[model samples]
Target: MEFVMETKNINKYFHKPKEFHVLKNISFGVKKGEFTSIMGKSGSGKSTLLYILSTMDTDYTGQLYLNNDLVTGKSQRELSRIRNKNIGFVFQFHYLLSEFSVLENVMLPAKKLGEKSPAEIERNAQQKLDMLHIGHLAHQRASRISGGEKQRVAIARALINDPTILMGDEPTGNLDSQNSENVFNIFKKLKEEQGLSLLVVTHDEDFAKRTDRIVQLEDGEIIAQ
Candidate 1:
């Protein structure tokens, strides 16, 4: 199977009064269209690893392959371009543009990348929103929507770019059990419809169990695959 994202000998460190090693020799692979989760305790560097895999942070020691392309030496400009075209990220806090409506919020990425015309982007955003079953809420301001609905809009936005891999960093961290389940259901919908590869970082056992594989991370390394 083709891998959508992979990391080999990934090591991330931070400098403060003392150097803190956040990720240590992390190596993993996400096959195309598979849903995988990274589970670890707090301060276990799961988020750090996710950011590296998603190409959100570049100052790490490792070889990362996204869609089989080596991403380590990619220029900032080129990395930004790759991230926009090939990757989608969801954070614990749904960072919806409060000023924009749900439809417009989902279209923001395409607009920033100048990937499509306004009318076309809007149409495509609407299509994804509808697929996520949130089309009726498109016109509402992002702040006005419930947490569950906001998460849905965020997922639709992530899908707007038609990315090959979607990475979520504790996407359900802030929601209640009910809302978390709802957010997770959207992931299932995405996997079924698009066969999109998913890499999720979470402490929630229930959410992790829903994925095709659960990887246990301990002390910045993969102890269980």
Candidate 2:
């Protein structure tokens, strides 16, 4: 089967205060266009594994492959480029630049990528906003939007580069139930219609249950898939 992401024998450690094994020999794979969730209680190392998977944390021993390319041990610059082109990230906080217009916020990543002209970038960003049903808010300042709108803007920003994989860390944590459900439906639509692969780390049971697959972690180990 084709895999969008795969991890093999992953292990992590924490030093400074003491040498603590935070992740132990974890392994998993995400199929192309799959919607997967990693669930765990506090201190289960779910976020740590996510960072490694996202190429944000390389201080671990394992092999990581994204879109069938081995990404293990790549230099910081190389990893950054790969991440910019192939992966999108959303965090618990929307992290939108309050001073920027919603459209500008979405266009920033494409501008940094520099693979498209300014006009192309603008059109693409606006398209993403439209896909998220927020195109009408494009000219508004990000700070002026509501919580749900901001989250949608953040998602539009993440999609600006047309990444192959979209990763989220507690993406719905800041929203109310209605907004969370909206976000979930958006994800479902993305996976089914857009063929986007998603890996979300969430503590919400309802959200976890709805994903294509759930990988459960406990005490730094993957207990179930």
Top lDDT hit: 2
lDDT of each: 0.88, 0.94
Task: Give lDDT: candidate 2, residue 184.
Answer: 95
What's the C-alpha lDDT at position 42 in model 2?
A: 92
Name the candidate that leads on TM-score.
2
Q: Hey, what RMSD does candidate 1 come out at?
A: 1.1
Estimate candidate 1's alpha-carbon lDDT, on a 0 to 1 scale: 0.88
lDDT of 2: 0.94
TM-scores, each model vs. reference: 0.96, 0.99
lDDT of 1 at 84: 89
lDDT of 1 by residue, 99-182 (tens): 889998999989888968999999999999988788999899999999888888888898888999888989998999999988
